[model samples]
Target: MLEHLDRMEAHLRELLEKEGGWLPFERFMHEALYAPGLGYYTAGSRKLATPTDSAGSSDFITAPELSPWFGATLSTPVADVLRDTNSLDVLEVGAGTGALAASLLPALAELGLPVNYYILEVSADLRERQQQTLAAWEPQVRWLDRLPERFRGCVLGNELLDAMPVRLFCWSQELEVLERGVVWHDHGWTWHDVPADSALSRIVRERMPPLPGYLSEVNLQAEGWMHGLGDWLEAGAALLIDYGFPQHEYYHPQRHRGTLMCHFRHQASDDPLKLVGLQDITAHIDFTAMADAAHASGLEVLGYTSQAAFLLDAGLLEHLQSLRESDAHAYVLQLNSVQKLIQESEMGELFKVLAVGREAAVPRGFRRDRLHSL
Candidate 1:
């Protein structure tokens, strides 16, 4: 890992030197996560858990990694989309370690709906891990190197939008909007802000007007992902669940440091420049921006809600009830994990679920309909 990080730093330096000593944060993040084999996700770091998983063995555990019940609970809404759209395909983007797919496939099959599960993963290491994890269900599973020209049925991603490369814009007291960038400093990389560029400037000026000293993330990649889906998805919905807030709260006065976060060995910090390719860097999703992009692209906003509400409404408790009480060890474990899944103090409120669909009803978890918040 040290050697990998050394090489990665050199690579980043080369990128910086080539781009006139300043590279946009989004481009840097793209390289950090997807720079051939040197980037974090592409480098095959052990980012998931297993039976013998250590406390600091991985960067952080996602909801699906915490419990199969996460995916089992999700099957409810997915099944609804499947039945409603009368489609049989499900596309999962950025399928980390394939835990969700491994759990969701059998759950969906048992419900009399054997889905043609497609994973659009970029990491060769993770693809191999997913392959091993889902070996038993290979017949129903496949991989896609790129987004399909057209897609039907449900497209889903858990904690995905947050991972996409985002353009950062800062609204300062001077009423100037600047684009965030990176450059080399004293023995390390650091921030190098430049004048805001293009539509990003326009969007910040219009959407975040008069916000003195506000720093936040805006994911044009998320918007583009949804826009592409809107163009190709003849039916069904895009179900995206991640940790984020709507636009208003996202750019609030108190958030001067922005939402950028980096995870290393299960600990999260408010820095993205330190470890570079050794940790996972992300920003909270701006759901309002995403929803607006989807709407502009012709996709209808079906539903949006907190993860707790989505799971409860989608029958998480029912799935829990079906567990065997006789298996005290397994039952206790699941019980604890389920609490973390639903408890607001944990991932419950911090993470939210957004569903953008066509011909699909308000998704089960979002039956309460919180699009107004976005």
Candidate 2:
């Protein structure tokens, strides 16, 4: 582990020197998380697990890891898209541990709709782990290194947009915009502010409030990803689940400090400079920006809602009742997990679901959606 860290640090130092001792935060973040063999996601590390799993073995746990019902309930909306489009294909981006695919495929089959599942994963290490976990469905599943030129299926991405690189910016007392980047100083990485370029400054001035000393991030990469969706997503829906808020709430006056976070061994921190490539670094998504990008790309914003509302509207209670009749013990266990998933104080409210597609029906999970809020 120490040797790997040394190599990763050296690689980062080389990147800094190449950029004249300063690197844009987005560039640094991209390399820190996706650099060919030295980045966090590119390295061979156990990244996902349930909280009950052996401590310190994984960096963090996602909603699918907390309960199989997450994927089971999600199958309803996915099936809707498949039936509406008359397609038998499902594409999942960043399929961690293949847990969602494993749980979702069986549920979809139970609903009398078996589809081809494709995973577009960039991490070679994660692809190997997903293959091992999904071996049982070998014939039905395939992996791809990049997005296809054209596709007709339901696209799913859980916690995907948040991991994309974001440019950090701050406002000065005079309301001047500045780009916050990284610099090598004192034999370590540190923060350095520079006059925001014309493009970045224009974006900040238009989207962000004129509050002095406010710090936040803008995810142009994620927006670009959304814009590209229309080119390949010929006739289907893309369901993105992540933690974020609308533009108004995202750049609200009170949210002075940005939504940047890091995780290691299930512990959360605000520091991304520490641990180099050994920890996970992420920021919150801007759903409104995503919706705007979808519109610009000629795709419709089908729906938007909290995870809790989406789950309930999609028949979570019915599934729970069925489980209760079959096994009382398992029912009790899952009830606890459901509370964590839907409660206002937990993942339920923080996490949101956004659906964008071309010629796709509004998913059943968005019956009570809050699209107007966006």
Candidate 3:
């Protein structure tokens, strides 16, 4: 990992020098996470270990990685789309370790829905790992380098959008917007601020109320990605699960420092400058913006709600009931994990699920949605 970081840092140094000692934080983030084989996801690290698993350690565990029940619960909505739309294919983006695919495929198979499972993973290393994870179901599963021309069925991504590169900016009482970038100082990296682009500057001035020294992130990349997905999606729905807030709450005056976060070995911090390519860098998604992108590109928002609501509506508790065994201790452990996934104080409130689709009805899990909030 250190060697990878060193290589990334050196590569960044050369790029920084060439760009006149200035590089947008987004570019640095993009390189750190997607720069061929040296980036975090593409480098083939064990980044997704179960929270309770004793066999391995990881930088973090996404909801899908934490429990099979998560994927099993999600299968309800996916299967709903597959059946309703009469589509035979499901596309999963950025499938880490293929844990969700492994859990979901079998659940679908149990219902005798043998749909073609296609993965659109950019990380070559993680792609290989996903193939290995789903080796048992090889005949039914396949990988795609790009979106199959005019894809149908369901599309899903767990904790995927937040990883997209974000543009950082700081605003002040004077209404001055300073775009944040990377600069090599006396020894290492530090922030370099300049006049923000006028369009974003207007957005900050009008949308975000004054909060002196307030720093925040704008996920234009996520919006653009959604636009592309919306264009490529001929039919069906896309469900994105992650930790985020609506636009109002996202740029709230109280959130001065923004939702940008960095994760390393299960510990969280605000310093994306230090870890280079060894840590996971992300920012909370702005569902309103994402939904807007989808809508502008011609898609309807099927639903938007907290993870707890979505899971409950999708029958998580009922699934848990079925998992009960004679062993009381094991059952209790499963209950505890489920609590972490749904309890308000745990991931339940922190994580949110957004559903968007074209030519698809309201999703089963979105029976009582809060789309109005987004």
Candidate 4:
């Protein structure tokens, strides 16, 4: 692991030299997480696992891994989209460990809707793990290296947008904006602020207030992704689930430090330079911005709500009752996972679900949606 990290650092250093000793933070983060064979996700590492399975070996656990019910319940909305759009396919982006696919395929099959399942994954290591976990659904589940020219299906992205690279900016009372970049000095990587470029400056000025020393992130890449979705999604809906806030709450005056975070071995920190390519770096999403991007790209905002609300509307309690009647032992175990997924103190309130579609009906999961909030 040490040798691998060294090589990753060397690769970053070469990039810094090529960029004239200053590398934009967005580019640095992109390479740190996705660089050919050295970045955190690109390299060999045990990244996703449930707490019981991890034993302190993994960086973090996701909703799908925490409870199979997560995916099982999600199948409700997926089925709604499939029927509404008159399609028989599902596309998942950045499938971590294939846990969701494992559960979703069976659940969808139970609904008498056995359709083709596709996964778009960038990490070769994760693809291998997914293949092992989803072996039972072979030939039904296909992996893609990139987006298809035209797709007509329900798109799912769990905890996906946060991982995209973001542009970090600090605004001062004097109305000056500075962009954060990475630089090597004293044999270590550190932050170096430069005057914000015209594009970045315009974005910050338009989206944020000029407060004294307010730091925040802007996800231009995620906006571009929304545009890309508009290009190929001829007839279907895209469900995006992640932790985030609406624009007003996201850029609130009290949120001065921003939501940039780093995860390593199940521990959270604000330092990204410390781990180079070893830890996962992420930022909370601005849902309003995302909705705006989707609208600009000619997509309709179908729904927006908390994960808890969406899950409940999608029949979580009904699924729990069925499990209780079928197997007592499994029910007892899954009940605990259910609590963690829905309790407000856990992922329930913090995480949100946003649905954008074109020529598709609003999913039943959003029957109680809080789109007014966005």
Candidate 3 structure, TM-score to reference: 0.95
Q: How many pairs of residues in model 1 come into backbone collision?
A: 2
Worst 10 residues of 2 by lDDT: 43-52
**How far in Å is the alpha carbon of 78 misplaced in model 1?**
1.0
Ranking by lDDT: 4, 2, 1, 3
Q: Candidate 3 — what's its lDDT? A: 0.86
Write candidate 3's Cα lDDT for 90-185 as tens digits. 999989889999889988887788989999898888888888889999998999988676888999999889989999999755768988999999
Off by over 4 Å in 3: 51-56, 325-330
Score each candidate by Cα lDDT. 0.87, 0.91, 0.86, 0.92
Q: Give per-model TM-scores.
A: 0.96, 0.98, 0.95, 0.98
What's model 4's TM-score?
0.98
lDDT of candidate 1 at residue 259, scale 0 to 100: 91
Task: Kindly list the per-residue Cα lDDT of model 4 for residues 87-157, writing each as its tens digit.
Answer: 98999999989999998999999999978999999899999999999999998999999998899989999
lDDT of 1 by residue, 130-238 (tens): 9999999999899999988888899999988888999987876787888988889999888888889777888877676567667787888888887777888888998
